[model samples]
Target: MKKLMNFKGLLLSGMMMLGMTAFAQDGASTTENYDQGFRLGFGLNGGVTTGDYFNFALGGDVRLQYDLSQRTSLTLTTGYTHLFGEDNVPDLGYIPAKAGFKAFVWGDRFYVLGEAGAGFAVTNDYNETTFLWAPGIGYANDVIDLSLRYEGANDFKTDQVALRIAYGFKL
Candidate 1:
């Protein structure tokens, strides 16, 4: 029994080490492109959510990014989303101002990013304020970009999955 347990532990440790190595290798592909410069882009995305209510939403966002280094950047995002009818929860909207860090791999076109920021309600009926945070995987080409993210808000203890797609110039 003792030998069997020892062998199991060793096997688990070996698998863990292998997984770590794979992740590190994937992380090594990150490279710099157009770093230390300013980039502005805009995009639109629509999706559905489930939880408090099953609803559909569409949103547009604009972002300005400043690359502080090859592996790091700071971004500011402002955006609004409109949720469709569900449970009489009139279409909801928000304007979010966020700042976060981004890390890139496979050049500037693919990345892993996370950001935290605050948002305020724009409509009179929805004077609620909330903090937002998201971690996403993104891909961009010369003409188009897309991202998948999970967004969380503190006020409602709510979380949603977001899919964003945009077309913008890389200047």
Candidate 2:
């Protein structure tokens, strides 16, 4: 047992060291060749939702980002989603306010992101305010941003897979 424990510790330590080294050597270690400090972007989003009541969704959003490194950023996002329903069903709308982070995985242009916040129902027909969460993969540059994501709300059980296309500049 003692020998096994020692082996496990050694293996864990080696793995951690390797991970740190790789992280430090990533392509996004520094903010260079592009504008930095802060940025703001405007996005148009469209998607397909769970077919419970609504089938399609469209939205607009604004995002503010601060780059901690060339490949890592903290972000604030707010958006409105309008759901289109079937005949006889009323359209529904939601406003979301979320805070999240983006991390580059392959290079400065490709990344994964996560965000969580609140979704407020804009119409009284669905007056529940729910927790909202999104996880996504994206490509971004100083001028353009594009992402595909799954956005979900807890209490209302509303969720969608969305594509967001955006334009941005430094602030």
Candidate 3:
């Protein structure tokens, strides 16, 4: 358990360092392309969960996004999810790490996204991990992002439908 926690910490730190390096490179670009380069964002979400477990989930995530073209971007995300339990179920928590792509389907502000990764669940009884994925549509601008998504795990019985709102700045 201690080793697993340490490994998770190390992985997150490494990812953050990599993201910072990318942001620094984008910031140092000499061409006008710098304005269209990479960006970093953070978000918070709260919603209800169903399918085997019924609960309220709240989560916060960080994303490093790189523009692939005028209408597309690649994103890497890491977050913590907490599910409030009811009745006999215990409170559950997860650390989700994922990579995805976002593309503007209608215009520069509206997009669709799909991400797949793993979720590490931690609890007093046992620690487990499972495959996780999400598919969603969103609207974004320079300062705000709003999205509705469905999140699920391959090994866990519960899934979630959430609406997330975020505030971000150019990096």
State TM-scores per candidate: 0.73, 0.79, 0.77
- TM-score of candidate 2 against the unseen true structure: 0.79
User: Lowest lDDT 10-mer window, candidate 2?
Assistant: 14-23
Residue lDDT tens for model 2, 87-124: 88788898999999887766568777778899888974
For model 2 the local lDDT of residue 7 reads: 45
* Candidate 3, backbone clash total: 0
Please give, for residues 1-171, the per-residue lDDT of candidate 3 as tens digits: 465447445644643453344333333324346346788889998877765555789999988898877666898988888877778888888899999978766546877777889999876453789898777778899889999877876566677778889887767
Off by over 4 Å in 2: 1-36
Clashing residue pairs in candidate 2, if any?
none
Measured by TM-score, how close is model 3 to the native structure?
0.77
Residue 59's lDDT in candidate 1: 82
Model 1 RMSD in Å is 9.0
lDDT of 1 by residue, 75-161 (tens): 888888665657766656778788876666555567667778987767647778899776676887666778876666667334466
RMSD of each: 9.0, 9.4, 11.2
**Clash pairs for candidate 1:** none
The prediction achieving the highest TM-score against the true structure is 2
Residue 127 in model 1: lDDT: 78
